[model samples]
Target: MDNTFDKKHGHELLKKPQFFFGMLLIMSLLGYVVAKGGVVSGIGILAMPIVISYVYLIFAIPNTGIIGIYILNFVAIGIVRYVKGVPLGLTIDAQFLLIYLALFFKTFFHKIPWANAKNDLVLLAAIWYGYALVQLVNPEAASRIAWFYAMRSVSLYMLFTVPLIFILFHKKKDLELLFKIWAILSILATIKGIAQKMFGVDAFEQAWLDAGNASTHLLFGKLRVFSFYSDAGQFGAAQGHAGVVFILLALSQKRSRRLKIFYIIAGVLGLYGLMISGTRGAIAVPVMGFALYTVLQKKTKLVLMGAIMGISVLVFFKYTTIAQGNPTVRRMRTAFDPNNPSLQVRLANQRKLKSYLASRPLGGGIGSAGNWGLRFTPHTFLANTATDSWYVMIWAEQGVIGLWLHLFILFYILTKSVYMIMFKLKDEEIKGMLSPLVCGFFGIMAASYGNGVLGQMPTGLLIYSSMGYLFLGTKLEKENLAIKAKEQLELAQCNK
Candidate 1:
């Protein structure tokens, strides 16, 4: 056998012994716990399987590539909160570390490709990470512990995920795989949400509601229907994000009939999830997303059509009193009303925040302003006042400088994506594929103005990965065009 083949064979051969030893080690640990503690210890031993599987999955993610890890990250965030006692939510960090470990070894062995390692997006991520690190020394920071708790989602995850996606998930098929996974998950989330709406909450869900969550989740005596997500805001905005993507994907030309059908189904279900979650802020996602999508089309006729449709929807909600009897429509209608009490409250809170933060250019520090602030330093003004918007939360924690940098990073990514869609990309299919995702990102960004949902799990991951893929679209399209041109030349030469 060849040397490379023999090495690979040996690697496989070693896996069995490693597996056996792993199991033996787990059993020994369980036995020790039992010896030290008894039945209580034996009960605690149940976590061994979760730990073993979690370790196995971390190593497994590299073989599945970037999309695989994204899907795993999505699934983990979607359900980990419901899984009691295991702290499975934090295992994602382990996955991130394991990926870096694998990449390091692969590089050492000359098996890792470095060609795709450099990009403007990757550079932007590095810059963002650097800014986040500097915040550790902010003079106004109340608690370093809170920064540790909150910064993972803020800058650390972005540092690793952006480069990883650039390395592995730049292909058109990878985009399709991403769409398939996202659509399926959105549909399933809607299904679970619908069950909660029609049937009722389960034991875990009901327990959560009863344990002080009901105050926020229940509005006007109607359930918010969060489903398996972190909360109703996440569920609603995420569903709306999916709805916009799939609906636009469905409308794109040259797609297969089956794909169109799949998109339509997913889009409808996603919209339903958005409706039932009663997340009024989520309505901004589709409205703003579709507006951006139309603008990106750059066709006078399509732009006119999109404008007319958008105006009609707004007019219906603002001018007409129709459908006031329907609860869903009624709640949605409130989103447009400027004088709505909640809107007033939000504005008043912003005023208060502006007054407090006027002098602190660095703000209070990352974790000193949100839920982490409340838990770690309850007496802080930002924590008690509620930074309802993601932007507000960023402003409260990072101060003006940090918030502006974050905004500039996002704006740069979105602007670059638009520039690629408009001028650089030549393949219609590729252009069509990226347009909605970029637009959807804009929508989520807009929605985040009303809620602190963007930097949380799944949404943050989705947006970061989308940014990588959107940037990669131009590269993939150029390669595709080159191949096509070469094939045409070859055919002509053969005919001559």
Candidate 2:
């Protein structure tokens, strides 16, 4: 009698006495849990049935699993603050893997367009992953466990995400939906950050701050609002990334007015989150993103206007202490200051790493730098060193050879995507839609110099998705053109 039953799942099975008994058993268990514990505990027990339903839904519809992975990527690390002891990060891995597992079983009947994922971008990701794999036997590697954990961020996510996007989620509609989801999450994050700013931190957030996070988060007197992200630095960078991407979308004349307004709202709120975050490094995201966007315009007047605006803002921050009263502005200005103590300290550390890594062409190996190094080998020299910059982490961990390879891959994507956007794509609308991906990619790359934001959660996955879609430029344009042609043909026939 359950409306949820389908022929595929055998609705007739409900006629059997065993089925009735099974339903009664489940109901009795739920009731027992509610009686013994409380509503919250009963709800927790219900999760098993819900999880089973979700598992079945994802196996039946692989795209839903992709959505699960995307949503989880944004919230996974933050979930740690609430849910203690569970390896929530692993769930992100599991979600994406489920998508592929479903696809694997499906391959027995359906012929998947595997060739869609064949491209330089995916190849480069594989090559980077292969490099990490090679680091397993790195002579200087202090911990295999470290390599396993660090490599997930370094290469594994990219390897997993890009191919999945190209093969499964390459449609224009899918891309638009992804961007809209991004905006919604960003809006929610900012709302959380604003609450933290206007009122105060919650119990969980306060506990996080008390547990040594206060050192970095609590500046002069202002609390760097981190929202639900791992830290203020990540929150600031991610918000600024959203700001750049959405503002670009808002500027697109080809998009609908409703979407444009939504993009504007998300963009402004994102910038607000960036301001409250007090992460000086994140300021680079907007500065560099807008600069790149202006140049991409290739119009003299627009470039000149952008330059003028850029200079005015730079001079205001660098020369005049106009907003010195404001903590956010004050902290951001330090990024431009050459003699700032923290910058000097970071430079000093880089110099030390340079001298240490110069002798070893292969360097300290994967997980030998950053938090992983600090954890697995606290007494080691590199472990004591802080890799403030993402590139520096790669250099310290992977050495000059690996650094060169990494740079090559990134630059190749940036330059090639630019060429495709600038020349290869015909439709102005699609170009506008895709332009933000390149701009945001550049912004994150530039910001990565100050903080290791690029390879971190959400940003890394998003970038890999961008790379996938950007490479699908020609195909997307064809689809766009087809739609336009159909519309025009309809109009002509209507005129007749």
Candidate 3:
């Protein structure tokens, strides 16, 4: 009777389409909310659809469809943006809501069979939470809103999005589809950046600066190209990362000549976008990402050669008129000058932070530093403090303990990914698939030394999504190998 009941339940689970359809319906409703009102009102209305979907998925689909909903919502928003003329800001807000809904729904699907927690990416999440906990206890940083803000940022950008993309996207075809979407959007963004550079009249940039009462002079004499993203910094960093990824992927493809050519074009356009944004920090992304790739491939000689070549190029650019003639190039040169007012100010701020953090070792709390803290949690230590670097912000807000955990998580992910590349897989296509992600991790890590790319949407999304793919790829590879071995054994037994 128990076996029959189990079988019946399983059969019913397999037949469930309502759960999936309901999820799409909820996403459509959320899309409508975002299209009508902005993010604030949209969040208020998001709950009902989420609740209804959750309940339906729980009783109907055996596998929690939260991740599916998240992806569906992402694709839906893209569709809405293309079809409804919804503003990027509104779309971003809607994406945030979808992320929250996905997280909430994931609770029901948390027990679904997938990759283990020891996976490098999962360890990264653990490290992130550990830092948050430290921030929670620090007296100097006891701001509830700050915690929520941190949670909101991390949850929406990394923790939720990455896992969902990895778990839900099971096929190579799906991965290709996602990459294609990413490429198309990225190319569009690059075109916008190029336009901004050429004619200094981007509606998005002007609107952003006017709304914030901020000036673009801080971006140096070069025109700050924002594209469709929130700021020039984010735009530049994202383009830089995407440029490298596209280029690497293009180089990796053993087939599809036309697609390879398109990728190469996309990569060049992306680099142009990065350059026009006038963010000197953006340069580090490709350097670090490529360096990581070389190191992981056990090409120590290649790494050393690349480093020497990079130094040579830097020296040439510095001494030659080739870079000086270019507006973007001239602006990037400012980043190297210690006497540059911005650099001086950042250094002074770091000194102040060092003194402050020395006594209050536990930190002020998460989201208590940078623009995020000022806007979201004004009561925390860094709410009024100045922290230019992401690492400094983490150190000031969460202290040494928090910083350690964060680093540990990143290192853990790096180690695991490296192991997978080195030992686990021999397939070139699989290696190519993983390369961009590994490079992205390195790029973000290096970029974070100067700016906070880790928390921002594009970079964060890329990181988590790549991490998810890494985890899933490793798991699938192992499963396939196991099944193949089992099949061989069964065939041998039958032959005997």
Cα lDDT, all candidates: 0.83, 0.89, 0.68
Question: Which structure is stronger by TM-score: 2 or 3?
Answer: 2
Per-residue lDDT for 49-168 in model 2, tens only? Answer: 887888888889888988888788888877788766667788778887888898888889898778888888889999999999988888999999999889998999999999988888
* Candidate 3 local lDDT, 184-229, one digit each (tens): 7788888866776677754434554666625753344556776666
Top-lDDT candidate index: 2
Q: Using Cα atoms with residue i matched to residue i, what is each candidate's TM-score against the true structure?
A: 0.88, 0.92, 0.74
Pairs clashing in candidate 3? 141-364
With a 3 Å backbone cut-off (N, CA, C), the pairs that clash in candidate 2 are none
Error of 2 at 396 (Å): 1.0
* Residue 452 lDDT, candidate 2, scale 0-100: 93
Candidate achieving higher TM-score, 1 or 2: 2
Q: Provide the lDDT at 273 for model 2.
A: 95
Which runs of model 3 end up more than 4 angstroms from their true locations? 1-111, 114-120, 155-157, 202-204, 212-214, 217-221, 299-305, 319-321, 376-381, 476-496
Candidate 1, residues 380-429, lDDT tens digits: the string is 78878888899998898888998999999999999999988988787987
Q: In candidate 3, what residue range of length 10 has the lowest lDDT sum?
A: 73-82
